[model samples]
Target: MKRLILVTLTLICAAFTLHAQDTTQQIVPGRVNSASNQTRPYVIMISIDGFRYDYAEKYHAENLLRLSGAGVRALAMQPAFPSLTFPNHYSIITGLYPAHHGLVDNTFYDRKRKETYRVGDTVTVPDGSWYGGTPLWVLAEKQKMVSASYFWVGSEAAIQNIRPTYYFKYHEKTSNDQRIQQVVNWLKMPEETRPHLITFYFPEVDHAGHSFGPESEQVRAAVLQVDSAIGKMADAVSKLNLPVSFVIVSDHGMTNVDTQHTLSLPDTSIVKALKVAPGGEKVLLYGNNEEEISTAYKFLKQNENHYTAYLKQETPVRWHYGQEDIYNRIGDIILVAEPGYAFSFSKRAMHVGHHGFDNNLTDMNAIFMAWGPAFKENTRIATFENVNVYPLVARILGLDITQPIDGKLEVLESILK
Candidate 1:
């Protein structure tokens, strides 16, 4: 009994230490804005995770509505296919489809590396080697323009051997006020050192949507909470007299799935012959070889009910997955659930809200709003792909795109002043 208690205490202390590390700020030394870059405009890119395209209006997020109305708003922003959190957020920043960026899913198995990259895993989440593409911060730092991140996907990793000059490991314990003040403090730094590009993220809406479903009062409350915080942050930043632009976006939108009847694998006979990675809206199955994969694929298609089975090479072209997979991370077979259904093995109740669906669905669209000095007044635009945001931010901060990316600048160029 004493030994068990001691072990339990040790595990608790270890977990607490990890969380503490997440809260502390991480600053890379020996980086500063160049003399030329010091005069460049500033942009604060904010991502509200799982904020649906219509959330601001549906929930009456007055502050967001007001701010977006004054500058630029999109009818909606289309997330890349497999509209999951990590993939789409990375897609927004890198201007690459998930397959192009190599973060093809929130959790994907890389056959080449013989490893699985799962979100929220302490070891893999911060490992730079798993990531590809030059993130905005990496681009800025390469050009002697400093950048910072309050919280954003890939911000914690040192992609291309560079992390933002100022960043924090993600931890949800920090209050809204503290996060806002931290941004204000960073902006007030000397011009030579202040980050010209800042990335901020909010996870409240996503949390609420998952726990209580998109239509619940809890989601409304979360939307209001984020709206209130943004209003405060923008009001405080405006007082600084700096030319700042605010681009609000979400990684993906939420949908309420049919919870009463969750979708399960149609065939269990071949389970022993395959490896499986299960996501809420999709499942990936890997087989030992072509014959094994073919057999499993045939079996799944015959027994298909709520889900559709596709061989990896035959996934929708728009998803940029399957044959476009550069890292060979996609499984041999993928099972995508129908919109109203979710894939699960547990008999227990599934989460009512879910994403990770086909991005072309209207319900999967996310929000996009740009305001402040960088945007035209009272401008509203049509739906645009989220990938284009990378070039838009690059244009605002005067950074050049160093490599080939899927996003084209012309798609969103009209919104700028």
Candidate 2:
């Protein structure tokens, strides 16, 4: 009887070992069989702040080269305006335009709350009121698939009472290498509970680009540092033998604006004349009443050196910059600077780069690259939009988020196996 019991225990141990191995080897269903027909595979979407298309093509970075050379690259990703970080990033995750998402700008007065919402604040959490629409992470959770985020707008919000299984508090001190490691570790979790969708954000490059021009040495160095970190992440993914897809994207590109290109709205006498506050770049003229609104519009129109004025409803239909509900989000009059000219209200001398230009300008066109089993290799797709990202992400995790979305699930035909 003793011998039989020992033998039984040994057999059970063998079965358990086999089960563990099988779990580790699990891969999502779907293979890149055809260029025309491809489905979502497990996805890891990385957003490198202020990453421009030219930076990848011209800067000669190895990790970017691997992603572009091995995977599919979009020529440019045009971000939704005011071309600020929060609004565009929110659009990317929700697959909705900023007008629909309600994060219209990086900093805007929320009339309902009678307060200002800034992207840098961590106090806003798990509040569906502040974060409109369903973010990709929240959608992933409903389907019982795990998701994780290092730093992404609304990731900490705890929307719909759902949170990524693993999340870190927002921290400026977090190193790029550390953030990458966190993502890799999450991916390395046991298969049954491992995050199917992971989002990693790198902001140092963007910060450097804003402080220095996109082509400045500081920005280039930051880019290289981010590139090396990305290489480490790619290596980690490879080592794990995990079948993962990667979508590398940016919110907006950056451009140089010297004093020659500077336009001060307050100096133009627009704000004082109208008795209202001047909105920053991509000029917004805010006032309390119709009389003030009319005055702001007249002031903008009179000053031809700095801006091209438009009524909130009449701002260019093609840019999709205007929506009925978005009236409160925008200023009374919209001011778009002429090419190379940046709008500012400060009198302390103008400096640095800006991205709130028309989308046609290359400076406003961001970067996008994707790789792995779900993508078609070495092919470029021009019809891509930032809003299209969420649908592809949703399909990867098998999340049934049936909410209406602006982005369509057009198969990325370039990165297929």
Candidate 3:
């Protein structure tokens, strides 16, 4: 009897030890529990500023060609309204529209503060006031996953006191090579601590596109240089031999603007009738009396040949434009120039290329490409909006973003192996 009892005790002890070992093995080190227990895939999101779909299609960029050859490609990424950098980039990261995200415009005057907020300016980062929604990096951190960014708008913002695990101060002259090196070094860290989500931004293409038209050789050279840098990044990731995915996207494409098609603000009588000052491509008109507002609206509308005008609440619903919440951020009357024509604040100034047009313009459509683990090869998806990108990224990282997003988890059925 004593021997049988001892044997039973020994077997129970062994079973418990085996169970513990199984549990330990199941717990992936540094892995957070998302909705799905599947191991999170590493993701690198690279933004080539002002990269147009046609640029990649027409240009002889061997490196970018290699990426497209290896992974899934979207013909064009439709950007949200204004089609500017800050709002579009923010939408890509947050999966929300500018109206919902509260970025409203690239440069919006604040009536209460009596100041102008430029999206690129770090000084304008309010005390949790600048950003309207949670960025993906912050959302990832909340789920106990690590994220890093090189330089993205609102990354410096003190909102929620959340900063990327690693970040560099935004510098206009930061070389493409330097940015690539920084990302590679971050990835070289041990698997347990390396960033699960990484973002790298290249601004030279946009700068060149703005300086010279999108079709100019200068922009083409910038695109090739950025493409080469992307190749270096992919090479480094390939060396890791881990199942990682890379995505290359852009904020907005560029359009050529001719001097003959320019409209000067000073030349318009509508400018003299406004209460508040105007800036950038859009004009802001403020009025205390109903008559002033009505007069301003009629003048701008009657001369539709000279301008594309929108009454404060009457802008197109498709663009998600002119919500009451964003009215203060927007002008009482908003104006956009027709294609080939750009609104110029000064007649003396000269800019060959520009964005910030309606979303319908093909030149305003951006680029999107994804390659590597769990992605389909040589596949092209139809048109997708910028907001859809965030959920796709979240799904890749195995994160559950609890907040409602404007974007949906797109049909990546072809990409999944």
Candidate 4:
């Protein structure tokens, strides 16, 4: 009797382990004989940081404008609330709100890890624990498809113990042309080893926009430079003659920020009671207890003219923020600056241009343009949010997603052929 009971327990444990492994292996991809069909569809998604929707027209980006005219274009692309770079970029890949993906802001305090994640901090940026949602690269890997990334917000991290087949460490010294050439080299690989999906990131536009105002000549020149690079890259891709598509997008837009249009907390007492996460147009404040939370909320709310304050639960429904289990990642009190204004703990000069403002503002809009075999030609459509992009990319890759995602493929289905 004792031996039978032990044997039964051992069988049950083995069965449970097998079930877990089977669940993980469920995302199998159908093998296609690469030799037979030399024209399997491929995708390249590029991100130009701070590329405002109007820049292509205002700056006369001939290359980008032409691509938009030839392919499908959107009036603009709406970024998620707080309109920062890291959050929205991750959101586009994962199809989850920043609140849901656990990248609440460019800079956030993670209570679980007892660390703060800053865009400039090398260690925090690559730590996978801070990321929640599985990025597109990981999804592609699960489906047995090869993917590569020049640079992406979460690509450096290994989410769910998986990373892209090919990705470089985040380095600022790499040139745009060099990055494009590297991707092209990947494309030149044998059909079996070639990447099915590749991502490219450019930060020059955002850098110029922040250093000089969005309307300044510096930004205009930057736009033109990136446009020329895109033109060259497009030519290179065309030479490959693969069934490829290019999806161009921006993480967010930049707006002019004046040093004079700054809001400083009037009540010093609120600071003593609250822990603040600074930077960006919006400021998030946290407290140790409910009493402190209420105190901070009341103080920020009192100055309604300068900014709008809300409890995490009361944040605007449309923003879709703070809807996840990681409530502490967002904090208790949220303060969104008024248009043309920014929030700062100290009254000082701000960068000439800034983002992270309310998503509804016209200046906070991003850009979207796509050209390829999978898209319609000479098409124009109304604006859509960045979250919807994940589903579109998944569909183009012929992958199924069962995770909780905020994106809907139907929103952008009209432009697909």
Candidate 5:
């Protein structure tokens, strides 16, 4: 009887082992949890640098207009303060204000490294230490979802020590077609290696806006060119019958720069001791000593018509700038040029267009539109800030976002199906 009992126990253990194997085989590849009943969805986020909110409306971009009607489109996307490329792009991905992300300016001094980080500088752009907050790609990769980036401001770096499964270093000269094809190739990867999240960047629109004014014919051509690329990608996705959510956005808009209306300070003792970094409509001033600070402040105040000056402590709460000064990177004084005005230290050269103005100005607004399996059709949403984009991405992918980000998922809730 004892031998019989032993044999029975062994048979029961074998049956339990087979049941567990069956359960494991039923688990979906992309879905980490079965509770959501969601297959991992594909998300492609594209950034058109310096593309203004009104470009599609003004240029008659059929593709963009179609996307707006087919999915959800914001009237405008209010960029964070400084309204520059690097900061706003990073803000959209991280769902944090530029102040919170620690990229307060496109060009900033790193006191810790004693080096200045500037755009187009290969060494600085790829260093992960300069970036703060976890971006969407980094967050997705943490959850075991594959990710890729064609080209993004900080994608080349391993932010928070996490890099996407696939990413390419940014090269401005890469043709738009080549870039789009690469993204298509990544999406075509076998299910075992496919990227669930991807980002693509295009600087042509911004380039055209800056070189020729936003209203110029060149800008219109650039807008249409990018529209064509979008149409092609959408077609490819449809052909594959792949479930994809495509998000298109821009960093900031460009406005006409008044070549005749320039603000130049005289070479006083105040000016000599002051270090001025001018970003078209915005400027940052640092001083060598208390005397320099006093002199520069008084000079700027005496001529307040050209620009408004603010101390680091007195920066407007709405601007959302100069948070905590943990890096001591924010300058002692901040200057914002009045609309239709430009700032210069010595000689002022005329640029066709410029940004980096107050965020409240309509001219500084960017573009936002999304279409895919998860969004509502024929949805037109009111304008929202770009910071909220991060949470939307997290929600679409069914990922857990545990970080302290400022984005609110409810802001875009109406657009979700």
Candidate 6:
């Protein structure tokens, strides 16, 4: 049960792996539940990456449908603009959009730091300085409430000098059984060391959506496997008889791209001159020279095929990106691919399924379902933004929001019992 300890989780990072992932549970010593929080209801927030809002009904994910049916089910959960994995997960956990949270995309460039933050980079992934806003686990720990994470965007890092009381560095090799047993073990601990808030993540659905397209049989298989895991986890947790609430969500939805004719800028020289941070459906290009950016934007706009180009400030107002880029992590030039379109570099083969498009698109909507002692049973609610999840979980675990965030508690308060 010492696997209840936590090690390095990045603001964007899991699994048992081949390269020696430290499976040791890192305990943030001297931390115990504050007396006032000792009896606070527990929260298990789960993210099934790329589990679209309609996947439950479309693919008949029985466990999710039944579980959410017994509690609260939302029409949809909107991902923040860009609709990528890391930024939206961080948005859900931090209640801040990618710009405000400083994770503008799964991979983004920071002019101030003169560095690129890529989700796959092990070196920068665990560095807390790259992340902004207080994660829920950080908020809980700040108030002396023990928290744990199976895997979360920032759980590996010492955000505000705090990691969950128990955590695993990002790795996928760890089996579902191992992950489930670890959660059970944590709950069996003495009250002082037990985690009141725990975050769990699954990447299979997203991986399948990316590799085989959202409608493929492979994706259905992935969704079913994740649904089965959720069912097992819920059953095991229920036997504990604790005041536990389960909040299940996804980072974003998936869509099929025009793989046969992927989008690319006509001017290779202009693209080559800028530092590029490319997402499947969008691309951010940065350079110190204003003229070069203008040239690239103009060139792309004039030759636009299945994509649209925008100067940093000219991006859609609803996106709350560009002009709101407080960290200047956004690029000087942005190109967003149209629905059914994706960007390609050097004419490389593109994946069948893609996201990172406008978050407002119906195809980009994710799922949200909450069930537990603290929620209203059989309640059906309208669609809401992923950011609001931060406040919802905070309200459930009785953690205070230390900073102003985009999420408002009222948006999700009605779902509570």
lDDT of 1 by residue, 312-408 (tens): 9999887889989888888789999889898875555677888888888888999999998989999989998999999999999999999999999
Q: Which is the winner by lDDT between candidate 5 and candidate 6?
A: 6
In TM-score terms, candidate 6 sits at 0.94
The runs of at least 3 residues in candidate 4 whose Cα sits more than 4 Å from the true structure, single-residue gaps closed, are 1-39, 323-327, 345-348
Measured against the true structure, the TM-scores of the candidates, in listed sequence, are 0.95, 0.83, 0.85, 0.89, 0.88, 0.94
Stretches of model 1 off by over 4 angstroms after superposition: 1-21
Those runs of model 2 whose alpha carbons end farther than 4 Å from true positions after fitting are: 1-41, 122-127, 266-280, 324-327, 347-349, 411-417
Q: Which candidate wins on TM-score?
A: 1
Give a tens-digit lDDT track for model 5, residues 352-407.
67788898889889999999998999888899999999999889887899789878
Off-target runs (Cα >4 Å) in candidate 5 are 1-38, 288-291, 323-326, 345-348
lDDT of 3 by residue, 1-417 (tens): 000001111111111111111111011244433443225678898888888877886777788877877778888899988787777888999998887787776666656665655543435643347677788888877787767787676665655677666765555455666667777776776655567888878887887877778888998898888888888888877887777898889988888877666665544554565644333345556555677778777877777655687876888888886764452666677887777776654445556777778888999999988988867787878878899888888888878888888888855545655
Error of 2 at 340 (Å): 1.8
Steric clashes per prediction: 0, 9, 0, 0, 0, 19
Cα RMSD for predicted model 4 = 11.7
On residues 28-68, what C-alpha lDDT tens digit does candidate 2 reach at each position?
Answer: 23211222112224688899888887787667778888876
**Model 4: lDDT of residue 32:** 25
Evaluation by lDDT, superior candidate among 2 and 6: 6
Candidate 1 global TM-score: 0.95
Query: Alpha carbon lDDT of residue 92, candidate 1?
Result: 94
Per-candidate Cα RMSD to the true structure, in Å, reads 5.0, 14.8, 17.1, 11.7, 16.5, 5.7
- What lDDT is obtained when candidate 3 is compared to the true structure? 0.70
| Candidate 5 lDDT for residue 195 | 79
